[model samples]
Target: MTTRLNPYLGFKDNAREAMTFYQTVFGGELALSTFGEFQASEDPAEKEKIMHGMLTTDSGLVLMGADTPNSMSYTPGDNYSVSLSGEDEGELRGFWEKLSGSGTVTVPLERAPWGDTFGMCTDGFGVAWLVNIAGAQQQEAQP
Candidate 1:
């Protein structure tokens, strides 16, 4: 088995909705486990909340998210951002449209200073994203 690094989002209470929305955007298999299902929480309210949710897209994108328990502190900030970079212009642009929909676009998707097309946006769930469409030369170099 190989180890991989993916984004693990921490939502206050909308892990299910947020993860589901991502499934629409990325077209993936979503597996969700609730606190009750995992027997991880005793409180009835927390039982229905998601303990862990994993979405594996066909494009090899893995996204994980979970609801934050009351016992834990959740501070939303600009500490982290999920980045999507590739040479597929159409595919990446489609992602940009879906991600930026109903969300705030900090940077429009267009030509960037470095010669690549790039953009930044925060989804409705308040998760920040950075999308970059690599130049022709960069794509050919990838294995």
Candidate 2:
């Protein structure tokens, strides 16, 4: 298989639910593994928590999520952001509607300084996202 980069989300305790929700929005296949299944957690309470979850969409979007292990620390911060960018306004806007529906829209989708329609939002799961609809200049520069 070829190498690829994808977003890996870290959740405090809702990895399974969050991943399932993403599957519904993106129309994908979701696979989940619990700490108990992997024998990776010593805490009984955390045994059933998600150790790993992956969602692969038909549009070739791969999203991974996992619950923070009992031994690890989880802090919500501006650590990372998942970015979606393309010239397909309709498709991208469709995603924005679903993703930002119940989430917080820090920046409404609109024209940006670089001329693209851009926005930033934090999903219901507290995941930050950046969506950009490429402008004329960007589309022209693409091969």
Candidate 3:
């Protein structure tokens, strides 16, 4: 396997639900492991919470996420952000809608100065995202 860069999200407590929703949106094989499965958490309440969750899409997208343990300090404003960029307008837009819904839109999706459609938002899990749709002329010019 070649080296790849992908987004790994961090959640307060809803890692499983967030990963499941992402699977529904991207259509992929989602492999998840809980704190109990790994014997990583001492708290019984956190046993079932996700320790690690990886979603590998058929489109070659890999997204990983985990629930933050209470033992550690977790602030909502920072940490992880995923950037989704490509020429697929319909697909990227669909993802933006699903990700931004019930969450906050830091930057509304719209046409950018680079001639591409772009937007930024933080998902319900507090994971930031950047979605970009390439320009039509750029596509046409590509041989």
Candidate 4:
């Protein structure tokens, strides 16, 4: 209903698995629809590929992703990483663990010189993510 900016990932053929994995880490409701669910595909193999999928977390995070149709060139890039920043250390840490479990951790989550816990990693599906836990001083309210 309102304007929102969120990550919409592109996968070669693993959109379902990747989205499901994200749901586990973010604790949310996931809705997925595939090409076959809507219309028959000329290519049998692609009929089941995801057309669109969305995950809305309890924390109000919304992430959408889909399998790149054969008609398009799905060039996976390292250009960006979905970032999560907040004062909730426990929640953010939990997400970091699950997200980096079967993936590569480019940066370990630890205290930073700027007084925050931060890390970056590429999920199993090749989607990058960054998580930051605000430090104690950051927990205070600001006018």
Candidate 5:
């Protein structure tokens, strides 16, 4: 497998729900491990909470998430945005619709000034996303 960069989301308690919702949107295999299973938490209330969750899609998308332990400070969103960019209009648009429909579309997906279809949204899980289709990104000049 090739090394790739993907988003890892952190949730206070809804990591399982959020990750499962992402499976529906992206059509991926989701594997979740609970705190009890991992023996990571001694609190009974947190035993069932997700310790880690990974969603791997056939399209080479890996999205990971985990529930924040009670000891850690949890803040949702306003940190980073997961960006999806490619030339596949159909696939990218499908993702945008599902994601935006579930939450808020901060920027409508349309022709962007950068010569691509661009949009921004924050999913129900409080995760920000930027989607770009058929982008004409700057390329290096040939020698």
Candidate 6:
């Protein structure tokens, strides 16, 4: 395997639901492992909780998530955002629409100061996202 950067999200107990929703949005193959499935926890309450969930899309997107064990603290914040950027406007816009559908759009998708169509939103699960659609001129200028 080659070096790759994949986003891993931590949820209190909704990792399964959140990851499922992502599969609907991104059209990917999702694999989930429960705590009990791997004997990862002795607590019955966490037995069914997701220990790890990964969604791998045909478009080369890999997103992972897991439920936070009761022994650890989970904090959702605005310190970070997952970004999607490319020259495919239609594909990127489709993602933005679904992601911001039941959530909040912090920035409307439009022409940005940098010349790309950009927007930011928080998904229903409270994960922040940034999408940028590269402009035609910008794409042509790139080598």
Cα lDDT for residue 94, candidate 1 = 86
Question: What's the C-alpha lDDT at position 133 in model 2?
Answer: 82
lDDT of each: 0.79, 0.79, 0.80, 0.77, 0.77, 0.80
Which clashing pairs does model 4 show?
none
lDDT of 4 at 109: 97
The C-alpha stretches of model 3 lying farther than 4 A from their native spots are 81-143
Which of candidates 4 and 5 is the stronger one according to TM-score? 5
**Compared with the true structure, what per-residue lDDT tens digits does model 5 show for residues 43-126?**
999999997687999988888778878976576664346767666666788889999988999879987654567787989998
Off by over 4 Å in 5: 78-143
User: Stretches of candidate 4 above 4 Å error?
Assistant: 78-143
Name the 10 consecutive residues with the lowest summed lDDT in model 5.
134-143
TM-score, per-candidate, Cα-based:
0.54, 0.54, 0.55, 0.52, 0.53, 0.54
Native-to-model Cα distance after best TM-score fit, residue 134 in candidate 5, in Å: 35
TM-score between model 3 and native = 0.55
Note each model's CA RMSD in angstroms: 12.6, 12.4, 12.4, 13.2, 12.3, 12.7
Candidate 2 colliding pairs, count: 0
Please state the error at residue 95 of candidate 5 in Å. 31
How far is 11's C-alpha from truth in model 6 (Å)? 0.5
Give per-residue CA lDDT, model 1, range 1-143, as digits (tens): 13243566888889999999999999989999898886767788899999768899888888877887887667776434676766777778888899999699987998765567878788999878878787774556669
What is the Cα-based lDDT of residue 43 in candidate 6?
A: 93
lDDT of 3 by residue, 7-116 (tens): 76789999999999999999999999888886777999899999778898888888888898888657776757676766766777889999999699987998765567
> Which model is ahead, 3 or 4, in terms of TM-score?
3
Q: Candidate 2, overall lDDT? A: 0.79
Per residue, candidate 4 scores C-alpha lDDT tens digits across 25-98 of 98899999887886635677889898768899878899877887787566778333576766766678888999
